[model samples]
Target: MTVDRSMIRVKAMLIAPNEDTSAHAVTLNVPTAENPEGYHRLIGGSVEFGETHREAVRREVHEELGAAVEDLELLATIENIFHIDEVLGHEIVFLYSGRLDPLPAEAGATLTESDGSVVPVVWRSVKDDADPLPLYPTGTQDWVSAALTRQRP
Candidate 1:
């Protein structure tokens, strides 16, 4: 096995919860060529050059959510290998679980990407058996469940 730096991407996901931990904040991805229907994903972005993973997470959260996160604890590091529009890609994801200083309203909000595309950010019930929208990065639901359980008292 060999590593290719060009194919590698770093993503920082916030496992943000509400006052009672009923739901979490997730972004509704815009439809792309690879996925016509799009999917729900953690609020994060790719790490930029010369930025540490932690800094990238914080920056991305602020940029995407317009808020600050606290008590960022590394929960998992996932090696994600998948195909998008027949193009093979890989990512080294750093999953961070933390809380939002001021939880947004239950209705959630929208975020605009650098390209001027609008993304809907919403709070979804984590206990749902069948999610109407697909969660991206494959196994994120399970990871969130386990993390939430571990966080409970």
Candidate 2:
């Protein structure tokens, strides 16, 4: 018997702090029509063709934030077996954390909106039990908070 399956796609959870690294905050990029709705996430993306997770992390940082990041390390991979619409897929999201030495200002971060529009980005401090905006994937708010407190591998 053959099992029909959808290939597992790699996801990225990019994190950047305030210029002073003042607090442990994160941002989630909005998506646009040109790109897949769920695909245009925050300063992160797929592993790309023939790219290592690290390389992809670096690339994603520059592409999304237009800045260089250091000390990037994997955090979590919460398997979310759910559908956005009627599509069957899995979010093998590979969460990575790093410091953007020269973090960009909120005004500079541009994300594609759902209606094919470029929108500005903002950093929300994941500090404490407050709920993050709906931009983030379900279960992400808690997972991120937990990852921040976990002992790095």
Candidate 3:
């Protein structure tokens, strides 16, 4: 397969056994250089030179949660057009799903950029359409819809 260089980011929707595959949602505030509220950032990153999509997903999860994924399943590949608020004009997010049954007890995860910061992780239902949800790249609606409808992973 020919890898496209245009969209250069990868992410994983780290999930656990929820209420029969309930809606899985997590919060991440993107920190501003100056802000009183203080924000959170999602778990994700760009693809490295010698990394595959699966590897990137694992790396991101470890960086964010300080845990390695023992069970990961591909849900779907959804292409999206994103108007990024952090980086370039657009990015294509490669979505993957992994199971983190017993959540890690560590206080934080390590990152090459942030030098390792502590962030909280949570699990929520994604099946509720009426409820407001927070997505990482902001263009994840298509991916979410695809994941919820696909076969059990």
Ranking by lDDT: 1, 2, 3
If scored against the real structure, what TM-score would every candidate get? 0.83, 0.65, 0.59
**Among all candidates shown, the one with the greatest lDDT:** 1
State residue 74's C-alpha deviation in candidate 1, in Å.
0.4
Models, CA RMSD each: 4.5, 6.7, 6.5
The segments of candidate 2 whose C-alpha lies over 4 angstroms from its true place after superposition are: 1-7, 19-42, 85-88, 111-117, 128-132, 147-153
Per residue, candidate 3 scores C-alpha lDDT tens digits across 23-141 of: 44354344443323433233455666788877887776666556576557665554445433333434555666555534542334233333444445444445535444345555455
Model 2 lDDT tens row, 1-153: 222337877766665556544344345444433234433234666677788777887877676557788878777765756554345667667777778756766555664422445545666655534433443444565555555565543
Please report, in order, the local distance difference test score of every candidate based on alpha carbons: 0.75, 0.58, 0.50
| Residue pairs clashing, model 3 | 23-125, 23-126, 23-127, 24-126, 28-40, 29-40, 29-41, 30-40
- Give the worst 10-residue stretch by lDDT in candidate 3: 105-114
Residues 1-153, candidate 1: write the lDDT tens digits. Answer: 233445677776777877777788888776666777877878777788999888988888887668889878888777778765556778888887788866766775887665667778888777857567777676677777766777521
Instruction: Please give the lDDT score at residue 90 for candidate 2.
Output: 71
For model 1, give the 10-residue run with minimal summed lDDT.
1-10
Model 1 alpha-carbon drift over 4 Å, by segment:
1-6, 32-36, 151-153
